[model samples]
Target: MSLQTDDLLSVQDVHVGFGEFTALDGAHLHIARGGITGMVGPNGAGKSTLFNVLGGQQAHQGGRVLFDGQDITHWSVHRRAQAGLTRTFQISREMGALTVLENLLLAAPQQPGEKLWHALLNTAAARQHEAQAMAQAQALLERVGLWRLAHERADSLSGGQKKLLELCRALMLKPRLVLLDEPAAGVNPVLVSEIADFIRSLQAEGMSFAIVEHNMDMIAALCDPVYVLAQGKVLTQGSFAQVSAHAQVVEAYLGGVA
Candidate 1:
């Protein structure tokens, strides 16, 4: 199928397998620019594997991936991130010992000080990059209501806070599309709402997202074109209300609960 003009990430007939197991079978999906695309399915429906494929962590044997009009199916994870694609995990991957601000600084793409020669010479560029990273980190922390904890060890934060930190780290790269595995998992109801609000705010600022989540509330409230996967393929794609009413989607994902 032809990718729409507004589509940012396009997965076309992608296939993945490991020995006898097929993780994805000709999966096709599109993430629209400046929109939040929701993905929902039951366990073993290949959601995480799909995320891995998009993040360049998994190698697919067939099909193509296009990002911003570029064929990037073979790109490395670092390359993808540099090309404006980044992701957050279901489980927070924050550095436990690092201070909150330090974590974000480490995520900044390029720091002159990271080079030994630049550090030895104490280059002005290094100082400037570091100063800029610090300012960005501070602003992000404040936006997430974590500025007061910027100096605290990342490990000391609550589960929800750690998720926020992970999201912020991904944002430090200034990515255009963020693949969120499950932003609401393990978060308190209040914090989940706050995180949803934060995501909506980011979307308003023109950041696109593809979210895999089981929290139907967040999916229904934040997503427009929701895709439901079953047996390693898209079972349906539509507004939450429409998909929830589909008999197959209800049976496959909600076990008739819907």
Candidate 2:
């Protein structure tokens, strides 16, 4: 397929292997600017591997990763984040000892997260940038209904709450595109909907997303031009309706699960 001018991220003929096992082989796809792109596949279909490649956590043996029309295949993880590309994991990475508010503050670009001790001591945490980060953190926590739990240790929150915290922390970077890995996996149905709403709102505000989720309900609701991967390659890509009707896609899943 030809690349579009509006494509924000593109993967070209990507290949990744370990020792003797091939995790990804010539994987390619594009995420449009300001779009919620969905990726769905069966277990071990290379979804997470692709995310790792995109997030700079996994290096591909061959391929070009273009972000915002620039080559980022050689960029480091921190460089990717600085360039407004960030990701969240299938598991929440919240610091168990950090307070909810502090978690967000720690993610701020200007804070460097090394001042958590000073923040807790209420010393040197009032610097101009720190104060601005605190304000930003408050707004994010409040928007996610975690403001009430700002002072509480992150581990005390529910699974759904932890997911929200993880997402809010990612937002602390004010990213242009976020790679969400299974945002609905461990979340309850209601909170899954809430998370979906939050993502949609962010997309409306011009943030793009590429989500790898098993939740068809969410994929149908939020994503367009959904890509299906199987055996380390893209099986097909189209709207949810189009792919759901694909026979190969159905066979690749647990009886239409994909």
Candidate 3:
């Protein structure tokens, strides 16, 4: 298939295996620029494995991955992230001991102070950069309604708050594509709505996303051109209404006719 310039991320015929087990089989999908794409499927459907492959956390045995028109199938996680792709996990991965503001600041790509020489010799530049990063972190915290908790230890935040922190940290990179693995899982209904709204607000500001979520309502409300995977392969791709009605999707999830 021809790669579109507007596709922020593309996966073409990717494959992965674990000894005798095949976790992914020729998974082909793409996240369009300025759009929220969702992935859903029954358990053991290779959703997480595919996510890992796309995020450069797993090595795929075959196929290619393209990001903003560059082949990144073999890129390192940090490399891919630097190239404008970042992701969050189903379980929050916040720094427990760090304050909320500190956690977000750490996700920013580069800091002059990060290099010993820069810290020692480039004091002026490092200070300026750190100041800018701190300002940006404060703005993001406020945007997500977490400004009041900026000084709170990350580990003290509730499950939903931790998820929000993870989301904000992913945004700290100003990523072009955010791969969210079940942003709503384990979150309260109110917080889930808040998370969904935050994503929509970001999408409006031109950030693209590829989310893997089981909340059908959330998917229906936020996604377009959803992809459904079954038994390690793509079963279908379309609007939620269309995929939910597909015979294969129904059978895969319910073991019966649609």
lDDT of 1: 0.93
For each candidate in turn, the TM-score is: 0.96, 0.92, 0.95
lDDT of 2 by residue, 157-245 (tens): 99999989999989999999999999998789999999999999999999999999999999999999899998889999999999999
lDDT for each candidate structure: 0.93, 0.92, 0.90
Output the better candidate (1/3) by lDDT.
1
Residue-level lDDT tens digits of model 3 in 186-240: 8899989999999999998888999999999899999998999987899999999
Could you tell which candidate, 1 or 2, scores higher by TM-score? 1
Candidate order (TM-score): 1, 3, 2
- Candidate 2: segments with Cα more than 4 A from true spot: 111-126, 255-258
Model 1 weakest lDDT span, ten residues long: 111-120
Off by over 4 Å in 3: 112-114, 256-258
Best by TM-score: 1
Top-lDDT structure, candidate number: 1
Model 3, CA-based lDDT: 0.90
